[model samples]
Target: MSDTAREGDAEGSGVSEGASGRTDAHESGAERTAASDESSTDAREPPRLDGWPLVGNTVEFVRDPFGFYDRLESRGDAVRYSVAGDEFCTFFDPDYVEQILVAENERFRKAQILRDSAAGFAEQGLLLTEGEVWRDQRVRIQPAFTPEKIRGYADAMVTYADRLCDNLADGEVVDVGDAMSELTLKILAKSLFDVDVAGRRAVVREATAALNDRGDASGASAFLPDWVPTPKNRRFERAMSDFESMVDDLIAERRTGDESEYDDLLSILLDAEGPDGTTMSEAEVRDQMVTFLFAGHETTSLALTYAWHLLGRNPDELERLRAELDAELGDRRATMADLPDLPYTDRVLKETLRLYPPAYVIFREPTEDVRVGPYHVREGTNLTLPVFEIHRDDRFYDDPDEFRPDRWRDDFESELPDYAYFPFGGGPRHCIGMRFATAELRLVLATMARELAFEPTYDGDPDLTMAATLRPENPLEMRVERR
Candidate 1:
């Protein structure tokens, strides 16, 4: 999917060139606004297509994101554009993305639209909060993702994979995406709270389906305010509430009743105490549990689903993966101990992450004035770092448009810049459950490789649709064959 990076610099990170993107000046987020202005002011602005009145590329961007982002990066690392009254300068450069994530944490923050859209969801988890609120949540929940704990979940992951394998015969057509979603949701749900949800599938499915449906563009909350009285908004609230309630009840059961009743992820979270021996409040605990259940499930499920799609379409890669797994762990489920030994399999996952990163667009607002490249970014300005674009940029990769897992060789480790390959972001604000997600993905992939082989029945051109995260737009049909 990417070319071997020439140097060890983290991909899409460090040291910017000159002017390509600019933002409206704001006074509050002052420090966010850096690097000598001389280089920026002299550099010519990048080319941009005109949009109606003030809404530049908003409609077109929403309609065709890949095309929208590709056009911006066609000329240089960064591109300038607008969305109605909001002026945005997107950074596809690795250095720029790197700086935003690692170098300038406080300079940039999550955008207002997301902040408000998820405001109602704030009490539901850690992802929606910023600053101290986010830090506090992270403190209490971090222990659940420790290497030792993630290792424990590997057995459960394999068990779920076995259950998934049992559901589909060797040569039956099935939607791999749907299957992976269910399997991942079940594993994540149980891993977080040791509860049997054989009866609760409908409840979980309904809530997840609603979150998935939020991708709709019609009166979309992305465009409309959350307070709007639209049916979609109401539905969103209803579904989210149902989802949150399910998690809240589970937390209550564990805290008050026999704590040993379950050994799931939620239980781990409940039993965890921060460095200061602080425990999460009941609301915070519920929020983090819900957060892990959803965050830990949906995105990776999407990634693995796409990986299956990619492999099903590309027989060569598929064979290579199976061969690797067979050679590495024949007839055995992938244990946490085997993770490091299967570098090639891990590389394949990394490549998939690069090509189809779960969290494609991580948007943040400038809490302080910051300098991105040569331009000074004012406070209140929206900053969108498109990993989807950065991953495909030809500057760092040899063949930017093609898919090739082999490109992630040992040689590129020191060569790629820090932020260039951020499927799971960077800095203190990165995805907290990264280690856990990695272990979970490896377990599922390895298990499926061992127990089953799913090939796309008819090649389906799965479209990338964004809703909270990117997912396969259409049903991904596959022919499942047992190994």
Candidate 2:
């Protein structure tokens, strides 16, 4: 929305930063190259990493993406590499990240890989749509996530957190990831859909796991054509069938009820009208529901799972969190009102997200060739903003890998560059449910922390996997003790 973002409208122009920290106009890459000495090398092309013939960086990237990214980051802020035959350029600098995601976002669209992977399940939803369709979808859905609506959903969040805590017996050993997934699914269902999905948990969980497995960018089937009947594809199809049936049932049931009485996302989508006085078709509504179901709960559950994992590893921080919770809401349920009084709890979640952001990477593709920082990125280049790498970059945080909530105590976020800590992304296209997720995380963590303490069953770091969301390669088990 800034003026800097609009300068890209002119062809053969580039954007660069001045000494005053404002974007300055510059000649296009070709123009600059032509004007310079013929013997001098062009600064437009980014440094490219050498890889094996044909396969390129596929093996290294598939085997250990984190390490591959580490090596990529070491090369330069703007580094280019190949995965199989596909081209990719990762932007590690926050300024370039800001340009891609916020300032000059209009010049980019969602990555083709993402669209291809998500199309089957999330078709035409806000997640995959572009231009006017996406804008209209966002406009229609915006009211459901307003401040008032989010505040209204807080009671459901706290109630479900309380329910999960009450149900967990003392000395119970549970997979923290699965547990959080179930809890968040319930919270999302009740708060957003105004429906109770307690009986449908198994189907939802299976479907979600299947979706994650199929959509794993690192999986073997990632590059295969979707029509290929690979084992993973078969499983994905079955799961999609079951999930679509469930969605259809939910929609039918909602329609049978007093639609005017409900103010949830389902009702909103059912009744929403666009500026042209159009309503979402049945398929569009289904797409929106599917998008929210996967996105709304998956990221938050991962956040809580990592929060507990981090707390379990750092007992001192856990003690500090429990102390804050005790002082703020002793023997009582946590509500939205208690969030202000529980700063340490908030910081713990913030630090957890910083270390283990569920939406670890944001993918974008340039709609036009544009200059980012000192490099000229060609149109259709797959650009990756590695949020995880940025968060743990030593230049940005001291002891970046350490679990230290106190570091976020005050002025920390204010001092950092805008894109330095974008867990939920940024710009007009930022996650629509950010407010809802933030409030849910705080309330749920507060409620659960008040009644239960987690002891991590594993030692040291858990093996991580890159997927639709960042997940533990193995189940993260934790022993729950009643507080």
Say which candidate scores most in lDDT: 2
In the order shown, what is each candidate's alpha-carbon RMSD?
Answer: 6.1, 6.1
TM-score of each: 0.86, 0.91
User: Candidate 1: deviation at residue 461, Å?
Assistant: 3.4
lDDT of each: 0.68, 0.79
**Candidate 1 lDDT tens digits, 75-143:** 566666776457677777766665666555555678875665565664547788776666655666655
Clashes found in each candidate (C-alpha, N, C closer than 3 A): 43, 0
**lDDT score for residue 284 of model 1:** 73
- Backbone clash total for model 2 is 0
lDDT per residue as tens, model 2, 1-483: 011112222111111221012232122222333433233234377899999999889888887888999999999898988885778999898877766765566778999777766657868788888988988787778778767777899988988888888889998899999989988998899888988898988878877888788777677677676778888788888887888789889999999988899988998889989889988999999888888988999999999999998888888888888889899898888877777788888788888888998999989998877777667777788889999999999888999999998888678865776568878775556677777788898988888887887898888989898888999889999999887
